[model samples]
Target: MSRPAGTKDVDYAQSMAILRTRFEWVMLIAFLIFLAVVPRIFSPETVDIINVMAIWVVGAHGLNLLTGYAGQISIGHAAFIGVGAYSTAVLILQLGLNHWWALLLAPIMTGLVGMVFGLPSLRLKGFYLAMATLAAQFILTTAFLFAMPGIVGGISGLTVPFPEIGGMSFRVPENLYYLLMPTAVLMTFFAKNIARSRLGRAFVAVRDNDLAAEIMGISLFGYKLRAFFVGCLFAGVAGWMRVCYDGCVRPDIYPLMDSIWYLGVIIIGGMGSTMGAIFGAIFVRLLHEMVLVASPALGSFFPPEIAGQLGSGLGLVVFGVVVALFLIFEPRGITHTWEILKGRIRHWPFVFAPG
Candidate 1:
């Protein structure tokens, strides 16, 4: 005799849960292996790009937590990243601290700062909250620019020393990859864990319906603030990595446009999905690199002066167009689209009405 429908659904859910858990383990192992041999398989330049993609994955995971899970909209994530990067520079250069100590402290400081800015979430929602954070982007950048120029390095920015431990220095992408790749992996693991935890569920509840979540005894204000703190903490770590990688921290490094791109990352990947953050980071960063390569070639078609100007503008234009396309066609982001594709492939040879 056939199983009851309810029993079949329970079986399906259990099987899916098991499959997903196994898939995550497999992917983590594969990614770690990829990092291990990345320098050997790719050119140094490509390896550098891969390193950057990993760092952005860290930042995007944070944004995914805040905007994706908690339903908060922010356009100033780069500010938190800036805070982290600058904090690292300040701590190491001014306080004469080691890179390891600075690294440990930067994210905590950024998270605290993020919590302060996140306070407005108690009274604001939607566009107003976005504007408030947008204001934060300007406020923080201005502080870096004009507040303590001598200490913060002002408009000139600060140089990050090559991170060294035990008299061993890391000055190459391959070397730095050893430190950054594992950090990214660990943070990604944490994000996955958070998504499955009680607090993560609380975040989802608030995102879905604040009033209902509050009625269920969830604290909307508290959860929202915590979401911002966690998200910004991720951005801070990414910023610190970038500073270490490039050996510099500048006000312009984490600009408004970059903040928009982070939002685009989660949107393109899939809101509220950890895998979505990874997919989004890879897709967006690769697209960025391609634009950089293609821009120079396209310049040949125009006068040198005009070409220089056009090349400068090409990245933003392309990014805007791509974001618009996704918003229109795949608002649920790449994760949802991938799921649909998989479903279609599995159920091939079946047809249904276009509901």
Candidate 2:
């Protein structure tokens, strides 16, 4: 006997739901396996590249939370990251603190500093707000370079000692991967959850229209400060990671260009989406990596002097071109593109079929 129409529909819906759940689990497992094996399978240099990607992605997540979700622009986001790096270096190297303690304290310190700088947001908006952040960048950079040079190590920078975790020393890429990848995974999960929570909704409301959000009982100042704190916390953690992995903390490491690049990451990846931060970091970093590889290969075609210059500069040119293309054609970013593709796949044949 044929099943009733309602029963068939219900069975089909249930099957689809089960399939979706299974697919999600399978994807998560596959990704975890990849993270585990990638360092072992890849060369040491490739492992380094992956490590850099994770570090920057963590930093970009912070910017996305501020600019993408909270509609607050920070041209000096890298300064906060510098704070974290310097803080970690001082805490671990100078103060004789444990790596674990430095890791915990860096973000907290950075968050407090961010909140202080973020006070300007209460009075500024748009270009004015950007200028305030730009000032912050200059001021913090000066501090890093000149203010109490003995403390920040001035321009020479501070050496970062190897981190000891449990009984294992993280002196090599294979071991360090455990420290970084897990932190990245945890922070990304935290960002994702924040985006779906009540505060995340308030952030969206403020971004969409602050005045309306105010009328709806959302405190602009409070949310804005919280966003900055959270964002800087992420930057601080990433900065701490840099010190741990690179074995040094330099003032120039977090430059004005870096702050801009972080913003570009979110723009290219898609604003207001956690995955967009990750996508943007991977996309931009991969482009930089490819340029590094190809530039030397193309050097043979030119004079040694010219080849050297091209090798050094071509990456920036390519990065600029890619950013321009994304702005012109896909302003909503890669996340939006993914969503469209996903919707099409779900709807399938009828999506493109003629009437």
Candidate 3:
């Protein structure tokens, strides 16, 4: 934590403060103000996109914690999310719980489910662990699709009405944006704190080397399961937001592709940092949105039959190429790139100076 000239910490509190400088505080306040007015300034469609981005940010944070910090890879995160969404629906519809209560309980239930799936980490890891989770993906999907059609809604899925208070309906994007954004921000704050805590340090230690961590008295099984529980917990929050956004829950909504994209989000945003999750979500979501917008215009240049096919697959092609390039050129992700640029700016003429 380098400080500007004439800035010196005189107390422990000031030294440990997150917003150590006045400039940082100013920027934080400005960013919050910008978020506050987004829905009022943007169109409904754009607001809807931002809402999805917020939800993805929450989910990506979870994946980052598991894969990035804990070194536990999961390609089945979307299934965990499905577990959360279905849990929420059951709590609300079958048990007669309030929507808000369902929202809280669903993620806890999902966390427990994640821990059960994570038991294999006791004996397996790396590629084998991924395969285990991949199996989890398929098994959960099957359960969602066919285990109990009457309860889970089968292919038809479950419907949830908009939450209401004081006669205000959250069915519209504009109204829902308020609910989603604050939750995103709060979750982000919570994640940032977690990353700075003892638990986060243990995760980092386990990630760096499990043998070394265990040598230092850190319990591998305890931390690994905790990582899975915490990671999937965030996925559940994202699932709850998804239900609010779409007013329904279906097996199709939580697909294998989404779980894959969540990994890409953390990879591109830079893996070990909290902000990487936010940056990655914004980048990937906006990229997909761009593909959606350009597909029709691109289709006009080709024959009708091929045009439809090209448009349908263009996003995947572009996304794959971009991720490949990022992996090759900047494997640490956008966060590292930003750090380098900031380092140069902080040193001015001595651009190569170390911070």
Candidate 4:
């Protein structure tokens, strides 16, 4: 039977969409498989780097959800993660809760806190909102520092129990890798789905034009809160995973600079793209490690004291330069560059000709 012209066009479009999606999934799966096998082929040190990269990826995805998709600027994201980490620590130390349950509930509690912070967004926008979030970072940090020996242990920090599954405690890097790898994969998957859903669309709409979104019957307040909750939930999960990875939690671990770095990750990663989150996290984290590794080599050219100082300062300078370069040259991020490359490849036979 011959289909009508409109029906045929719709079918063709749907088929192309499905093909594109399948291709993306295939590429992602292949990359993940390569990552999964890296430890087997490389040294333990390399595996450890991969593990750290995975954790950053998880945190970046959460930040991406807010700053990228939802169009919310958050400078205090590390505070949210700190909230989750400290919450988990308190639960285990003071409440005598199981580590597993603490991990599960930490994100939920953090999400609630995020919603409270997001409430300011309904009345504020742009720099004001950014300032509010900055305040959250400072206020939360101070609270953690001054909450006494009973709350967050003040300057001392809290010890995190090793993650246990049934009878197994993940003490080694390899064991922790197994636990972290799955969570990272699942978090990435969830982020991708959320970005493709009605909620994601609503977030983009709010970001693009909150007034128009409101005119279209979308509740600006509701969706903004939802974005905050979702983003903070990811932060909370990342925090829980970090505690498991580090075996302890400290207020010093999450500082104002760390929150700024999270924002930089989303910006350099391409904001709304899941692939962007992965790319940004890997690039930033690796660049950080590279600076540390190269510090000694750089130090050999200078006096030992000078070299040590240069090494300490170079990391921040390099990070700042990278962020500035991306902002000036590739504002859409590395993901957009990948898209352009793929598009050119897909249309290689149909290169445009000067008319």
- Number of the top-ranking candidate, with lDDT as the measure: 3
- For model 1, give the 10-residue run with minimal summed lDDT: 1-10
Lowest lDDT block of 10, candidate 3: 346-355
Of models 2 and 3, which has the larger TM-score?
A: 3
The Cα local distance difference test for each model comes to 0.86, 0.86, 0.89, 0.85
Measured with C-alpha atoms, the lDDT of residue 90 in candidate 1 is: 95
Candidate with best TM-score: 3
Candidate 3 C-alpha lDDT tens digits along 1-355: 4554457788988887777778889999999999999999999999999999999999999989999889999989999989988988878877888779978999899899999999998788899999999988999988999988988889888997777768888888999999999999999998888887888999999989999999999999999999999999998888888888888889898999899999999999999889899999999999999999899999999889998999879989988998999899999999999888876776666756544
Q: How many backbone clashes does candidate 3 have?
A: 0
Model 2: lDDT equals 0.86
Off by over 4 Å in 1: 1-28, 344-355
Displacement of the residue 209 alpha carbon in candidate 1, Å: 0.5
**What is the C-alpha lDDT profile of model 4 across 1-355, one tens digit per residue?**
1222223324655554423355557987898898677767877777778788788888899889988998898999999889888888888888899877887899899999999998898888889999999999998888888877676888878886797888888877777788888889889989988997788899999999999999999899899999999999999988888888888888798899889888888878898999899989988898889998998898899988798799889989998999999999999898988877765555555443212
Residue clash pairs of candidate 3? none
TM-score of 1: 0.90
True-vs-predicted CA distance for residue 288, candidate 2, Å = 0.7
How many backbone overlaps does candidate 4 show? Answer: 0
Q: Which consecutive 10 residues in model 2 have the weakest lDDT in total?
A: 1-10
